[model samples]
Target chain A: MSYEDEINQDILNSKKLPEKLEISVLRYFWQSNPLIGKKTDSIPRFLRKIDVLSNFSENELRILAKYLHLRKFQPGEVIFKQGELGVGFYLLYNGYADIIVENTEGTDEVKPSSKHILTLEKSDYFGELALLQEISIRNASAVSRQGCELLGLFKPDLEELINHYPVIAAKLLQSISLIVANRLFSLTREVQELKYKLSSYEKDQDASN
Target chain B: MPQISINTKRERFKLIFFISTLLLAFIGLAAMPRVSIPLLLGYVIFLIVYPAVPTLEKLGINRVGSIWIVFSALIFFSIYPFVKVVPTVTAEIENVQYFLPKIEKYVTKKYEELRIEVREKTSFEIGDKYFFQALDWIRKTSTNILLNIPKILASLLEWIFFIPLIIFFLLKDGKKFKRGILKLTPNSIFERFYFLSHQFNKKLGDYIFAKFVEASIVGITITSGLLILNVRFALLFGLIAAITNIIPYVGPVIGFIPGLLFSLAEYGPGTTLGAVIMLFVVANAIDIAIVFPILVSKVVDLHPLTVVVSVILGSQWLGMVGMIISIPFAAALKLIAQEVYKEIYQE
Candidate 1:
């Protein structure tokens, strides 16, 4: 028999309920769901680094795993185009992804080439800010460097989850607060350096004159 | 292929009508005088059983074992509290009953003096009819509630047996129940309803968890304050406040009644009056200034007036149960309304 026929036969044989089912039948039905991919569990390590699911309990994590959709990307396939509506977060399970930004080569010295601003490795996750905060298009495009597996958790699910689990919502808020605070600190440092550089440039100009 | 098909509007409207009809039937049953006791008992039983799923899951026990563990835990949680407090409180209640007539006499005398004063000052007539009418109304209401005692007892006994059994089956076959529900749906509306239900479940779970935490905080604070004041039945009174804290605007009023009665019984009217006033102010201050703003922020997006109006309307329609569920029900309605508006009217 062909593989499809064999699989169909297997399903028929398995149709009879087992003498004693161990898990919640719901878990069994979910486990059999075709939407959940073989490597869905692999994505959790990467997603754990994202603030959203970091502190979720095992049951909560499992619920999240079921909710997330698995999407695969071949090399050079854009995970998300830069200027599209962002709906979900992507977790890189097994391949490299590059975050590309379109900008002149230098801030002052303009050039034609756009930059690969950042490259992310395995266990890296992105697209969260857009999903979490309902921002417009992503700031950069993430292209898979090779064949990759990713789990996409949509925005609406997250909001619903947060509403149901206020603790999780509270934690998400806390995480956002931390991210904003970190950005503020970095911006402050960058501003101070820029001020110093501008003052030095003014001194050089005065000396030249 | 999408594992769960996204059904079209035709399929969804059918399911929506079906679910809405079922819910309306439940509400009707809940509102009926005869069936209200059983319906409440059944609902509470389901609630007790439902929480067992997680409690068992958390313990890393198998589903059957988890059900047993949860069953045992609930029995302990409920029975233990009553065991510790009920006897003492019952004895106190008996004492209060004996003194009730004397206290009423004193209150009437004081009221008579105030009535004479008011009669002299204003064009007000002091009539026993008004007082007797008020007393008669209270008696009637109390009797109505007491008449349901047998039904309530039957429900309690039924719950004692039925909760565990329902919980076991729920934990065991809940997935099947859900899947069966899903399978019955026409493919057209499956996806949207599935997604919406998922969204609703998550929101509900979070709302309950947050409310539990918030109520606990309020309960503990009130209890501690009452304990410090050496108030009678501090734990019980604290619990009353905490439960009342569930309802917005009206919770503090419910909390204050028991506190006032306890104060009156323990101390005379003059001395206890100060304590009663302080209890209301403090308990309410905590709820308003601290507990509410922190616990349930943005969960119910209705304006203050809207919330007040909804509560009153809900109370009128379904009494206390309506009051308990009104906010969340209103919130769900608001959510569905917004979604429908955006779907139908938005460009």
Candidate 2:
């Protein structure tokens, strides 16, 4: 018999009513009910999709979720401005954000021109340096592209987490450190590639001369 | 772009709404002292006791279980003081009023004797106007406070009911309340506001906790010392010392004055009086040498002038509660000021 048919057949063949049937019924209502039950599990499920947070267990993610502050931003609202002091690391929960850096070398005008660095979608995180630095200045501004939701873990929250859950704090710090290391590695490789290109261009100029 | 300007306008509106809501809440709290007083007291107590919940949780108890344990212990300890100390303190305060006349008589007699001696030696007549006026002022204020005791207790009774309930809820859902407030905070100022508030709260908590321990040590030392010496109104005097110790710099002297006057009038210039003097000196010495340095000074980190100014400002604004809260309030203001300074100049 097919799996669904066999389960149905077993239920039909059972002579005595199943024990704890009332509890099973109540639990079904509790879990499947639209209003209350699923909300608590949603944050942990969201955290599970984050690449950096993948190492955190289901329980750890739940604990981490308690420390997060969910913030909503309207379209075109500034998340943070460049050169401003920051103390939060945030993950985009929904919608999109654009990272923009001002071109300081541009001619003085009424407003300094800002260049778009990148757009971040769901599950993307930024401002990890703020969590670790003593005095962190935002290197780039992030503005919501079309209204977004963010889950922010701040310095104060991190401090409390460290005090209450050292293991989880350590895991979080490790993840943040991994992100920083990866970014630094790629940046160094890009600089090396540029250096090689510069030398090759110089040699070609010398040959042409 | 028009979009950016519209967003800016909307953000500004949100910020204004957030600020006005805060102001309205403040006004509401001020309008009703009955609820606010207990809430303020509960918040202070919560700040002091809330750390224990985490400590209990670290021992493997669940969060709710840990909160229950800490709260029950708080209630258990408070009950004894409520039961035993209240009546004795009330009785002592009542008895103190009757004893004040004897102290006044002794002081005037001493002044008369001193006046006679000074006239005989230097031929300069000393006026008793300022001295008598001062004496009258002290007597009137002491009597006024003693008379107000019943009224104070009526409110204290209300606090006894409300504070615990408030504290219980705060312990259980304090984070939820905080998150709720955070949700209301405008996004433009969210991170700055959050960091400043958290820092201020931590500073306030540490300062209050330190002051509490310091006051208790002083109170217990003086009370037990007086009891050992067979002094009258030991509890009353100790309680005064403890309450006044919440103020900085001048507090110890203010606390000592009542005991000094009472000891002189009650026991005269003899061994008992000398011992009383010694007790006040030792208790304050311990506070200055040990407790102040170890507990208080670190938490406040304000200049002495700043402390004095804030205390004056605080007393002018809200009397005793203002004085008690002044240092932390000043510290918070300084933190905000520093942040603003950095933004304006350092950046």
Error of 1 at B120 (Å): 4.3
Docking band of candidate 2: acceptable
lDDT by residue (B1-347, candidate 2, tens digit) is 21222277888898999999988998898677678768888999999999998788888899999999999999999999999999998888889888989999999999999999999999999998999899989888988898888899999998898999999999999989899999989999999999999999999999989999999999999999999999999998999999999999988999999999999999999999999999999999999999999999888889999999999998986678778877887998899899889878964
Tens digits of per-residue lDDT, candidate 1, B205-292, equal 5566566677787788878877887876677677778888777887878877866765774576675568656866876787677866
Model 1, A1-209: lDDT tens per residue? 95446556767888654455445755877799987776646444445666645666666566666546555555665666554446666666677778876543355566644467777886667776765564556677677676566666566656645644555556655655666567679999999999999999999999999
Q: Model 2, chain A: how large is the TM-score?
A: 0.79
- B-chain TM-scores per prediction: 0.77, 0.93
- The top-ranked prediction according to lDDT is 2
Candidate 2 residues lying further than 4 Å off, grouped into runs, are: A1-40, A105-112, A198-209, B1-6
Query: Candidate 1 chain B: worst 10 consecutive residues by lDDT?
Result: B1-10
CAPRI-wise, candidate 1 is incorrect
**Candidate 2, position B163, lDDT:** 95
Could you give the fnat of all candidates in order? 0.00, 0.55
TM per model? 0.57, 0.88
**TM-score: which candidate is best?**
2
Per-residue lDDT of model 2, residues A1-209, tens digit only? 75446556768997454454456656777788676646557888899999998899999999999899999899988899888889999999999989988755556564557778889999999999999999999998889988999999999999999888889999999999999999999999999999999999999999999
